[model samples]
Target: MDRVRRAARRAMFAEKPAWQRWSLRVLMTLAWPVGAVTETLYYLSVLPPDEIPRRALAWADRGGDMLALAFSRNVPPREYYTYRLHQPDRRAWITACLYAPESYPLLSWLNRRNGADNNTVQDKSRFADLCRRHELPCIATLAVFRDGSQLWPATPFIPALPLLWVKDLSGSRGAGAARWRLDAGHYHNGDKQMTFSPEALARQWLPRDCLVQPCLDNHPALAALSDGTLVDFRVVTGIHRDGWVEVVATLGHLPCGGPSGRRYIVGAIDRNNHCLISPTLSGFQIIKNHPDTGAEITAQPVPFWPAALELVVNAHKKVPEFSRFVFLGWDVAITPEGPLLIETNSGWGAFNHQRGIGAPLGWTCFPDIVAEYLDFSEHGDAACD
Candidate 1:
């Protein structure tokens, strides 16, 4: 519901007159202080009393330097951006404050800025629009794409593309991605075809603001007609003080569950080390075939590991603002001879499957790569490379 609501807001906002929407935005920005005050009162009830100031200071530091207005000072008034969340470590900094410091959300750019297609693409509305504008095969993503058992409706903007990619906005263990083939009759499964009219597919199953991707048709391109499972690449990168990027690890995946026209995905993480975790099975274990249908499982290790490397190097220049931040992870998709961004992430999880799949063992031998490209290092190319 949340994801859908947000997308609806984006559609409405996008259609509104520029000055009218901007004016409303300005009004909302001004009213944020009221919400912050209520938040502070809630914290006051929880804290001991003495640690409030100390806790607020810690968040003030982390909510991004050059503090937001209403809190920019030597003492730093409790700004809404950095002082509201009262994060895990933030609450600890204060001796008695009940609140974990909140993040100051003074800057709207972080929430609105655009990024590559393959990185953790969360702005379902923004990115979908970009793909439509550029005529690229992409997916429309929503931040809260789905919640538990409910899926948001499809807010597709383009009919020109035949492929639509839907991703659950909440997570990535390959948990949220789904592929949809919009053709005349209905969705095509591995061996079976379940037919549904276009009307029902939109009103009934599809999630709100999904990245409706045009299927990577391998027919004309590959010379042989094979409807193989599409694959995506992940390249985690970070910026060094010197501003050069390094590549951490590129993990490739082939779907296991097979696109059911709507829900469910079964895929394996191909960690470059000769290890391929079967998407048919969960975790590090590999399954040879689909559990229900017994279809044989197969995969193709990325033959052009070096070309995948070049794409990562080029990303830093492509997104100048994304250069900051301590971490960024992306699932890069292959197109023709190069790569197209599938999604980007600020909080890419540290999963064992990922390391086993092909991550650097301990950053000792691969220090330079992880720092700039993988976005894992506190130190960028400055120290390692």
Candidate 2:
């Protein structure tokens, strides 16, 4: 019965014209509020009954203005705050309410402009070219291109490099990233062996245009935390009111160094932005030691923290097209030479930051942050909202 139902759905979907299918997707995206309500109910179901009223009061106190604003815009308050209730901290829910799409006009506008296909900063190949042209310190990335049915490597290779990371130019969260290693008489991608023939590889990896680069050797400070897995600092930066770029939040994600890759044991960065310590699973559980090696990560100093911040700031300034984004998430690797740019995220996720600190972002405290991004002054006194 399940197979028949699945086949029927697939046949129906395939019968639709491409334009019709795309239109349906767009409509579904626009109707996120409906799905948001369903999600909120699921979280509410898991909460303790005795503490519900107390948490509700806190939510009202912290997210009242934002919630009211959302309601006025025909967006339900629960639609915005639902998923956040799963967090141990009640503040996460309030923060989500404060930044809900209906109330935060700037978020909606930015989403329309730079979300999905519109965002170029997420393009790994394009970003590598930018870095090369600007002479910024970054890994040498070869952009793979497709010619007819054949895919070609961007640069000549000796077939003996120790390691390479093949990444989808438009992928994120390490989903499209794959590691290749030169082994005895054969090439290996993770555990699978690949044919040495270029044509074989091209046929194997369809829909070309990938960015290939040498695997980054972790700096000693980061390596100490998570053996060989690449540990990086996620730096959140935004344009400040005074017309200067500044770091808003910084955190570290240490991998457990196994098949469960990039699933980090999150840590809180110090006020100085130079050290990471007191690892936690998004404020849900305290992680005292590395899951793989049992090494302590608490109160560890990250080497060359100041330089990493400066490099990120310079990189952000070079991209004028991304200025409208206002907020960017940067994955930075601290190498022995200096800091290297791993990638930049326009639609950066908030799970790690919110979970790591277990606190609300500045949405409620500073309503002007959203106002400034929206250019509210030109829109005529958005102060009333």
Candidate 3:
């Protein structure tokens, strides 16, 4: 029963080291209040002052209860009224919390027994190996290092490759990710500079588990969109019980050259997964032209859209360990050859896609993922439609 599972989870959490439990509790306590205030402000911005109290009461009656409404901002009253009222009980509110980016620590802990290995997805070296084994088109690794020591039987660095990317195995948001050219090395973290070095590069810049891979010369079509910087498509997907893979949502992150170089420009995708319009940072200030090259990407066609979808769906099916992740965001690059796997993300941020877009998780696919999981927790039925 769901009650039994919750009790067991609480016991397991209590058994953890006191420091670890205390730290996690502190994080949840701190984040909950912030999320509550922020969500309240969001509702106030969109709703009438007099309607707020009525809406709050409705949310509580629907299973938000007192603690759920006060501690979590994953679901607002408006969203529940709009998209979740059809479901019985407060299932939708529970669903929102489980998938919220802020709840990752708790969700990962609860689902750890399901065999999700976030480190495998975080480490570029390990992820690259997974791609190679699956015969997926991916950036080839030239060398790998750990703690300042070179890994044996390396992939052989090519002196004439023109560009090499140095990455921290566990880095995110481009932290510690860098590009090395014949002239200078470019770090994505604040654009720091370093001279290229095969022997000492890892120690100097990386200083941790690191990997070197040849820079991908993106397909000409993709290059035109961002003036040659690698353009990554964030394709979020889910897998169903009947072995069907579904594309949940897709967005594009086009980096354009600024005075220094182009910063990340995020954009929503059209129905066909093409760039909808001039990409914008913060979902405002439409960029009609590239800052450096002045090329227009508004409504630009994304080459091989169908092939890319197939590749990602198949890639998801190949990794059983990843099955535990009900939702995942895959970073895919369009190359001259075809679609290439850049990286996989279990904890993808929703702000870029959902910030200005007023919709719940199920609006795109309408899959009752939370309902399916709840049934499984209470009835031991894992099958989902």
| Cα-based TM-score, every candidate | 0.45, 0.70, 0.70
lDDT for model 2, please: 0.58
Model 3 worst lDDT window (10 residues): 1-10
lDDT of 1 at 262: 22
Query: Which candidate gets the maximum lDDT versus the true structure?
Result: 3
Count: clashes, candidate 2:
1
In Å, residue 109's CA in model 1 sits off its true spot by 18
Model 1 regions more than 4 Å off = 1-121, 127-163, 168-177, 182-195, 203-207, 218-227, 257-281, 286-304, 357-361, 364-385
| Model 2, span 298-378: residue lDDT tens | 756788788888887777666555454566788888888878988788655554565554454543222344445333344
Q: Please, what is the whole-model Cα lDDT of each candidate in the order they appear?
A: 0.41, 0.58, 0.60
Between candidates 1 and 3, name the one with more favorable TM-score: 3
TM-score of candidate 2 to 2 decimals = 0.70
Please list the Cα RMSD from the true structure of every candidate, rounded to 1 decimal place. Answer: 15.0, 9.7, 7.3
Tens-digit lDDT string for candidate 1 (1-385): 1121122223334434788876766775576566555554554444434434467765355344313322332112232222333455433222211111111110111223233233324554444454445444443433223332233233442233455555544345544455556566565423434444555554433345333345553212321112256555566664555766665444444444434432222233444532234342334344565444454444334444456556555554344545544336666665565555565665443332233332222332223322232212232211111
